[model samples]
Target: MNMSTTSTFPQTDGVMTPRRVAGAYLAEIRSECLRYLRNPGFMLPLMLFPAVFYLMFGVLMNHGHADAARYLLASYGVFGVMGPGLFGFGASLALERDGGLLTLKRALPMPPGAYLLGKMAMAMVVSGLVMVLMLLLGVFAAHVPLSGAQILGLLALGVFGVLPFCALGMFVGTLIKGQGAPGLLNLVYLPMAFLSGLWFPLSAMPSWLAAIAPVWPSYHLNIIAQRVVGLSDAPVLAHVWILLGVAVGLLWLASRRLRRHG
Candidate 1:
């Protein structure tokens, strides 16, 4: 559907229930995604983070063990995709909520799905860009070679990698205040990355630290990404399903929170 077609959404119980205006939703999604693009603040870290990890663990420090470079190249690539899902999505949602825009938007005839779908679309867009940058580093600088099929497979892995985090981000946004979102996300991001075996293998951590790895989505995502990149023996589809399950559970929790507060 083109943007020009105006569909009149019928009111249900004195409120117009938003039907999906594909074009309108797409436009809004694009606009929402563009918000980050206009500001260069987010770009620098996303572009540099993989390289930073590469340099720190891959070359200079060499703390990741023998296959550290390859392992980190894939691991950081997955983490790069996740950073946007967690940080950007949470930041935007919390800001809109505290600004009272979500309330205003809810009063409109727009579909309830639009808000969420917009977030998902924005997450996908941002994560896709982040993955591209990370992959470029892997190919050009990190000395990791990926074939055409592997690239396609990597895209699938990246998408699945972000889904659960996107759900958690939504949940986090609902729970945290706007002004505190940046700090809250950072708190969650760094700890989760460290504990979930993203920075290094679970085996390398202390026993207590290793004990917590099973509870995290990032751990599962790491294994899944490893499988996708041909680095592990785990079944790729199973982990993707597990990640989907986690996303679905978080989305449900977010729904409950939104309804309770709405």
Candidate 2:
């Protein structure tokens, strides 16, 4: 059989039912999650860096400043979520594209969306883990006061906020060679984190530097996150809309690139 030809699976009544589609999606998600978890090189850094950063900045450095702890908790949570989305999607997609795995997947009976969905699912799961760890440290270790509602809201936002970064990762993966993806992602990731006020307040920087915040999705995410703790006065919906727009635009660009490369 030609590898380019789609494989056929057993079906009932010659129709793909909702149950079957759901099963396929679950299978893909499981596979992706396992693949991510098994890679210590990837998973360790993704899971550890954010937590460590939170401990250093949000806990130790905050030095009994509840306000600072609350701020860093939210900022680091956003930073934590960005890793699994940006690096996960960027590196995985680039490797798959280079290894011809994408072509093989295309020939399979799986829904095309399953590939992206699996990645998104993995990123969200990791995001949730990061948020939980951060929350524990913030509430107990750092003594950051947060109501139950605020905690829940922060977790929800962190998980969903990975969408734009995932789209961004896909775009970057499609644009670069597989071997260079990691370096490229680090360069973009670290600088964006600093510029977007994830590590510290952008207001402390030069006015011109602070002016660049809106250009990065991370900045908008931080704005909404800060708003959750009463640090920012910007409308939450506005920041969400900005992220939604960026996600849509990046997804479109990535799809176009994939089509050309495919």
Candidate 3:
């Protein structure tokens, strides 16, 4: 008896279907981000919050701390970038999960990777725009006094720092019911920002604040930015490690949650 070998061949339906699903996800994300942009009132508040916080803490009410502008710029930049990650992506994830979007995706034949990949891509794009807004506020409006290299470094800290928090936000969205999402998100974002000293340098705050600062994701994120803005020549390995660890941990948790839900 001769055994017949199956020849490898491309499946037409397989190709088009996944492509269309991925495309649709992309389109949906773009639509969501653009909706925020179209209404400046919503996005503008996010842009202004960090700047206001920086000014209120680091300038107008500062107690003559060392390098206030530079330090505050970095901190606010961290807080600024995280807005899109938490508020933006959190809301998106909440809406999708609550509306049975992710559940629906479970029935589809497309690769599961596309669901997450599309969200991450969307998050990056939206966060990038918010970063630009924060950068302008830090530089021109706030007068943070940073160099070109420092500027780029802050951007890295801002963008890279969002990853873990975004993952965490997604996980949170998964856990909470829809009606409680917005309030729950605010509860997390506001306290974490203050606790992390995004409004003031931990050094100037209570010593206990500094001790607890590292535990908040914003602390490590801002630490890198502070070094970049104020101590541009300092080694950043430690800060980078912190961001990576947070991102990895959150991502792992988010992945597990997604699998369980699916």
Per-prediction TM-score: 0.86, 0.92, 0.81
**Model 2 misplacement above 4 A:** 1-14
The residue pairs in collision within model 3 are none
Which window of 10 residues has the lowest lDDT sum in candidate 1?
11-20
Q: What is the C-alpha RMSD of each candidate to the true structure, in Å?
A: 5.1, 4.6, 6.7
Q: Give Cα distance to truth, residue 89, candidate 2, Å.
A: 0.7
Residue 117 in model 2: lDDT: 95
Poorest lDDT segment (10 consecutive residues) of candidate 3 = 8-17
**How do the residues 112-174 of candidate 3 rate in per-residue lDDT, one tens digit apiece?**
566665566556665666677667866776566667887777666665667877877777777
Q: What is the lDDT of residue 123 in candidate 1?
A: 74
How does candidate 2 score on lDDT? 0.88
Residue 15 of model 2: what lDDT? 72
Give Cα distance to truth, residue 251, candidate 3, Å: 1.6
Q: Indicate whether candidate 1 or candidate 2 has the larger lDDT.
A: 2
